[model samples]
Target: MDFGILGTLEARAEGRRLSIGGRRAQLAMAALLLRPGRVVPVDQLMAVLWEDWPPASARTQVSIVMSGLRRTFRAAGSESEIIETRDAGYRLRSERVRIDTLTAERRVTEARRAMREGRTVEAARGLRAALALWRGPVLGGLDVPGFAAPIRRWEELRWRMAEELAEAELALGHHHEQIGDLTSLVAEAPYNERVRALLMTALARAGRQADALAVYRDGRRVLDEELGLEPGRALRELHAAILRDDPAVGGPDGPARPAPGIRPAQLPQAVASFTGRRAEMDALDSLPPDRDRGSDRHLAICAITGVAGVGKTGLALHWAHRAATQFPDGQLYADLRGSRGEAGGDGPASANVVLQRFLRALGVATADIPDDPEEQAAMYRSLLQGRRMLVVLDDADSAAQVRPLLPGSHACCVVVTSRAPLEELIAHAGARPLPLAPLSRDAASELLRRVAGDALASASPAEIDHLAEHCGRLPLALRTAAARLAARPRPAGDGLPAPRHEASVEALEACGCG
Candidate 1:
């Protein structure tokens, strides 16, 4: 028997399926599927089923629905006590059942890790295996209350995985092979800057730089007419790079250049002693693909908004590194300098300037790009309308800054890291808001171990715990502290107290005040 919750809700036994009966039961299953193996309170379940108001016999109805689901699982040959009643409410025992969602996630995660390690062949294989698991729109047959969020989330993941798979192919130099899929993706998400960017890259790589530049122009028009926004910095830079034929910027012939002001999404190799954030890592990993399939001009944006040093960039980069393969055309990252700058004119790079650079990277000529910010944006978007790419915009100050940079289509996915909550993006643009918090106690400790190694292993567990707490479990703070310790001249054999533990603790405590 197989129980799949990755894409859609399904229970099948030897090719035969078990029915969920009604929308209520389906909704219950969907809710459980959203957070498998975790106990969901009955009240929460009721809210999911009825939205605002529950019927008088909500509890009794829930019990009855759960009982039916349990029976269905049994009849479907799932003998591992699929659902168990708990003091809190109910917990689903998913052991021994084949869950497509879990399987897909595992496959994609493995692929991401492989790509990080430079194991391109293995990453490609893993991505293909993961993509093969999708049957249809996840939970396609089920219509239930509270299903929208999970469903959309799953679909987003699916597309993201597909994008990664395509990227892996691109890394293997399979540009022409990906053209078909890229075409469809571009058609579906016409406004996705990343997608258009990738398409341009692919075209350039396939010996069609002219076609690539043309794609950017088309995308530019769409953005101007529809959303009144311009292409982002990455796209513009790509165009310029292409025009200059800059081999250093990951263009056709030169050494692969890293995006300007863009650091790797993952921790630097210099800071190996990192710890905690398994859940955050998982959440980052679990972030669904862009979920705008209906409109060709769909723009899927995920804004990681939080306070300073909460590890927004860390989480974003980690996931981006893992997901780089999905955007085979290329991975583009930019730091908007939203957080750091002085009063002088030498402030963080502007959106228009960034766009210009991105366009060059994709093969746009400098002269072809206009001087006016609006025209530059339009030209930049036109260059990126039909590709599969991942664009990370870090430290955005406001939606206005980000709005102009959003791609004109959904063929690409954009991850924006910001300190403030972008309500307009979420409410108006369907951008999912992922609020990053501090690491959990365990995650914080693990981070410390990764960084400091056995040096801190023998230290008092309580003290270590206090230390993690003192850092507020923020990845940046923890990293900074760990870096300071690692830089010490003392040998590892020396039994030295963790330097600046008290000071670090005090600083962390102060962070809480803000």
Candidate 2:
């Protein structure tokens, strides 16, 4: 039996071909393809099917779809097990299948690494090969909410990879060849400043300096007229460098220096003030120490997991920031993209990738790190065996997604933030979970004081209470409201507009809350 997901859905067995009919089956197939070999939880599948509001028969409908997909696979003359039902949900066995999406991703990652290492020619070849695997959008005929997030993410990655490939080609002195493709891309995505910058560089490299300057001017005009924002710093600098005929701008040697550090930009925009969770934070800090000195029995692994935008991350970060001094070695932060539509975008970071990054942060050289993921993870654990490092794994998708990255010794503490409560992490890894609740009335008022400043201090106690109640007592919503109030002009003679409790009430009511 042969399973091919690189293009259209095709499973071949013996001498016959199987037909998968209906849009639902196709969508089911697409979802399975996204994860390939992992079990997509039943609840998550239901959410995908109904998107925040599953009908009473949603579970039954999902089972029916799975059964239909199985029959379709069998009818295609394949005795292969395409889908397997588990205790939680279902898994698609893709061991022998040729999945184009996986292939494309693999190629693109390889090309990106090669390009980073100055192997432009190899990068271009690998990227071109990867691009060739994409015939069209994945499961084009299917329109399911479950598929939309992953599909959109995949499409965006595809375009990013394509842009990288074009840049690689230009670096390889194929500027003449890249002109047409870059032109088309620029037309299609005029607001993509990165693409425009690349086009200008390509034009300049191909001896069209005047055209390159025109490209920059045109891009700047478009941005100012349509978006009313200046070009990004990088684009503006590139334009200036081109105008001055700076050799370093389009030279084969690339930029003269690397950026200062590899750290992700600090969370610049302030999150809404945290409300409630003080007891939860205290409980997290009070977890029992490990008993075994030679083994990891004492230090607790505390996991904060909940639904998206439910303040799991907010609570974890707030607590971690406050408790930074406890873990004197360092405070490590990673956005694992565990839950989509929650924090970061889709496509959670792999455990190996996270481990590699963490190890590097701990002063391990890139070359010193082992190539095998298992070895890398082991090395990471070994490094953290006796250290008191505070590691925050934010937005984790699953237990398996984070298992390998765990610190071996109990001396170190790990705070994980996830959308789903990882019961197994608690049972198996001795992880303590701190469930977060919405803010209390007093806590909400204090948060408003922090955000609204003196203006909130003068507001009537009754109005403040009404405002907090209206904001659903959720920290994020309350902060937004407070910020709104702070931005408004101060009232005359110490008098303010009447508190619009009904407006806040209506907002919460729309969200199905009090």
Candidate 3:
């Protein structure tokens, strides 16, 4: 027979639940399950059944309950050897029964091992499986007097593990999807730092930087007003990173120092035909002053975002090239692959892995780079301190993925590009958002002329407008249409062109934009 005490005290024969008895009998089985394979002394049973006082007939009542429990076990199809009778009291035959508390504890151990090995998905699954065993509060209906402490401790363990499962989900880049659940978790556990931090991280990753900071504010107030303590270092640092519009840049491992004084010029060559975004560039030149907390609109780092092919990276590169002369410290850039699941052609680059490269770019020796992502961020931020450098984090995946790359202080500017807005930078790091919209028709036509050269010059303005229409007025699409027009041979003998679906514009665009 399988018995469960993590919730209601019940037994199952062949996986079907069975109610064994009322309060007195449940107390007997639970007492045995609590210390399976050992004898539960009769006096202790009397103490639990009758708190602070026991009647003269306590022994007789205990004997009757024990007899009833044996009958219930026998009726549940257990072998006659399930419970043993001893002169002192009784011993539960552990080998003959299954206990859910024991089962769940085993799963917890396995999950912990999986987590230690960085198998977070497996760990999360295991934790969820383990937590699923509890149907309700441990020993809900049959609360024995003097049994509160152990039950409370066990409940605490379940909650902690539940929070851990949420953290694992966050680590896997399910930032936007987990917001609702995480918000509920935080509400249920306001003082729980893990839940609060995870909630903030989820919000920040989902382009709700303001909400993320507000969560911290609320959590901080709760901690201060209730616990009389300040927010921990991790939460405070996260708050600070948001204020900088910088990627936090933490990873799985620790520190390393690469070759010293090695300023990396990692910026990609700017697009020669890059055009427009004049207003955005002007806005970048002027920024708002720092506000209270870490919310600074005039970002030391700026994030450029828009839909796919809207030219986020191209804009950042064009502006970076223009401002390159001012940054004597040097420029560094990485295609973070934040949006389309890949920064380049490859898969998304985790923050820890990218921080390793950034550390090397700053001239620190490889041996000195920390294996931990946070340590690398600290060193990277230190090297960029007071240096007029430009860091381009392109195609980022999430805010946590970028936080380590952000410098803690000033004198360096970073330009980040993504298909979707990264609101964390704007909310906390004083990042200026330069959202790129579709180019105007005039701009689109100009871009096409510049890209296709004389091939497009022969076409009438009406034809060009048709082509632009087919190109969706997006720079990437327009360039593609221009390239296609350039490749096709002009009508032989100059026959009048027949109207078509503009087959050259297949909605196919380049692998990247800005």
Cα deviation in Å at residue 460, candidate 2? 2.6
Looking at model 2, the pairs that clash are 6-100, 18-76, 289-298, 290-297, 290-298, 290-299
Lowest lDDT block of 10, candidate 3: 249-258
Candidate 1 lDDT:
0.72
lDDT of 3 by residue, 306-397 (tens): 88887787888888888777777788889877654443454567776677677767765343554455676788788876566778899877
| Candidate 2 lDDT, 1-514, residue by residue in tens | 5544545666556545556667656666667788889998878777766778888998898999999888876766556777899877999887856677777878998987765444557778999998887667655656666777777877788789889888777655667788899999999899998899889887877778788889989988998999998889999898888887665455332321112232332221324556677688788767535434556266568888665445777877777777666766666778878765453464777677677677657755343455567888888888776777777888888888879878876877788888778888888887888766667789887887788776676678777877877676677666666666666656654533466644344545544454
TM-score of each: 0.50, 0.49, 0.49
Model 3 segments more than 4 A misplaced: 249-514
For candidate 3, give the lDDT.
0.74
Point to the candidate with the largest lDDT.
Answer: 3
Q: Give the whole-model CA lDDT for all candidates, comma-separated.
A: 0.72, 0.72, 0.74
lDDT of 1 by residue, 372-478 (tens): 67876787576566666778888887777777677775777788898879898888777878898888888887776677665565666676676776677787777
What's the lDDT of the predicted structure labeled candidate 2?
0.72
State residue 513's C-alpha deviation in candidate 1, in Å: 25
Model 1 reaches what TM-score against the true structure? 0.50
Any runs in candidate 1 off by more than 4 Å, and if so which?
A: 6-8, 141-145, 248-514
Residue 331's C-alpha lDDT in candidate 2? 65
